[model samples]
Target: MKTLYIDCFCGAAGDMLLGALIEAGADYEAISKALNSLGVDGYTLSCEKVNKHGTMATKFDVHVDDAHDHPHRHLRHIVEIIEAGDLPKEVKEASLETFRRIAECEAEVHGTTIERVHFHEVGAVDSIVDIVGVHLALHQLQPERIVSSALHVGSGTVKCAHGVMPVPAPATVLLLRGVPSYSGDVDGELVTPTGAALVAQVADEFGPMPHMRINTVGVGSGTKDLPDRPNVLRVMWGDAVGDFHTKESITVIEANIDDMNPELLPPLLEDLLESGARDAFITPILGKKGRPAHLITVLADDKKVSAVTDTLLRGSSTLGVRMRKEQRICLERDWKHVLTPWGDVRVKIGTYKGTTSTTSPEYEDCARVAREGGVTTREVYESAYAAAIKGEYKDA
Candidate 1:
């Protein structure tokens, strides 16, 4: 599968992300034409090669006309502008999702509804271009998966419409919920609201760069002079090396509880999955004193370990939890919808080297159909499985 990895060594911003995509071989004219097609005027997009410290990188800039100075805009207005624009369906959806994330954060920070929240910096014409153009560039790349490293949010304070605020700004910090990030050595605002929203929207997994065969690398330089490190973001285009299905990492967290209520274990498992655990379950075991106990195990990616671990600790009576990192192999898989006698059921198809290896019905869909049809879930599963095996399932 084709994959794109973002390396935020210094930090990221809207312009910086676009620059990286351009450096990674995105068509600049096509992106500009897309922005123009939006029917929003008074801005020009420009790119040039520049030196950041000793490394050469591309610098992206948006020059907006003074005549189009509208500093504040409501979330609904921004949504309407995007919906009316002439853009690819995928581009429009991705752009709208990013903007929605920003609005949600702003609303939470200001204690207001999303519609009532007023956007200052992010609602500007230049920011609109950056966010929409970034999605357009991503659509051109056609990556099957996108991964990113832990973000390096800078230190110190930044002045915004809300006056002087701590580094990572209020909106930025809120958007970074569940994202892995840390303050860098630099003393300034590194991750902007636009950058935070973009990354939070696009990135599928976050941690160290995964193992892949490098095809190309792009360096996007931010327009800032820092005392500690070069202000730049690196993007890499590549494919998985060796057996693509064999390389993956997951953290296994386990805790043995003897005092927790047995009835609460089910809800704890649900909480763990809701908190981003890949999987969670409990196994009956015996404690040291020969008492019956439960062993809670949670499987999660490295980025979600903290959140999942917290859930495990808070929901269980265990004093300590053990953790071990393990590698897992998975088959390439996708979903399909099968038309059953009663309704459409979702099926999971696993493939290996262009051949189907396994076919199974989605349990949630089967359960729902069974409840409505007054039948057993097993019957629904068998029907869907047969349909999938006979190549009778249609793509949803």
Candidate 2:
């Protein structure tokens, strides 16, 4: 499968992302044609090769007429603009989703509803084009999976519509809540709201670039030319290397508790899982006092360990939780929809060594179909599995 990895060494912006994709071989003329269809006047996109700190890169620029001063727009207005634009269905949806998230974050930061929230810098014509252009570019690439590295957010102060604000302004901070980030020696905002929203919207996972055979690489230049650092974003496209099927290392946390109430266990587990625990389970155990205890275990990525541990401590009466790193070997997995007598069920197919080794129907999908068809989940699972074995649905 093809994958796209974003290296946010100097952080990412919507224009940078779109520019890198175009440089990596997305059709520039097609993107230009689509933008022209938007019908908004007084703005044009310019793409060119530039050298940044000794590295050649593509610089995307949105030139707007000085006569047209853009006013801040509300969420609904932005949505209407996107809806009226002539963009492909997938591109339209992705772009709208990115904008919606930014609006929601702004609303939350100001304690207002999405309808009442007004766009600040993000509502400008340049930012709008950047985001929409990014969506169209991503549609052309059609990567199977998207990953990113830890974001580099610069420190110090920044001037905004709301006056001077600290680096990683309120909305930017809200957008980057769960993503790994750091602010350092750089004396200005490295990640903008548009940039943060784009990354948070599309990134499937954030960490180091995994093992892969790189097919193409593109460097996207940012507007600000810092003296100490290259203001650029790197995009890499490739296939996974080696067996590629081997799962990366993940952190697993386990805790044994005999003193906590059995009734309290369910909610604690739910909280942990909801807070990003990959999986949580309990196993019966005997404590020092010969009392039966529950062994609670949580599997999660490295970034989620702290949050999951916090939830456990706050929700349960545990003195300590044991943590360890372990390797999990997972068969390459993908999803497919299968038609059964009841309804459509989503099936998960796991491939090992390039052959289907296991097939299972998603329980939630089965439950939903069973509820609508007035049957049991078991019946749905069975029907879906049987259909898969019979080649009713092909691999996704």
Query: Model 1 over residues 1-396: C-alpha lDDT tens digits?
Result: 567999987888998999999999899899988788877778787899998888888998889888875658888888888888888865776787788889999998999999998878899898999999899989898775689888899999999988999998998999999889999678899899999989877886887877777888988889897665678999999765446534567899999899988889999999999776889988999999999998899998664676788888888888989999898777666678998877889898776666778898999999999999999999998999889888996873
lDDT of 2 by residue, 1-396 (tens): 467899999977888888899888788899988888776778878999988887788999999887986777898888888888888766776787788879889899889999988887898888888999888888888775678998998899899988899998889999998988998788898999999989877776788898776999978999888887778999999766446535656788888898898999999988988776789999999999999999999987664576788888888889888999998787666678889998888888777776888999999999999999999989999999999878688454
- Every model's TM-score: 0.64, 0.64
lDDT leader: 1
The lDDT of each candidate is 0.85, 0.84
In model 1, which runs have C-alpha deviations exceeding 4 angstroms? Answer: 243-396
RMSD each, Å:
10.6, 9.9
Report the Cα lDDT for candidate 2.
0.84
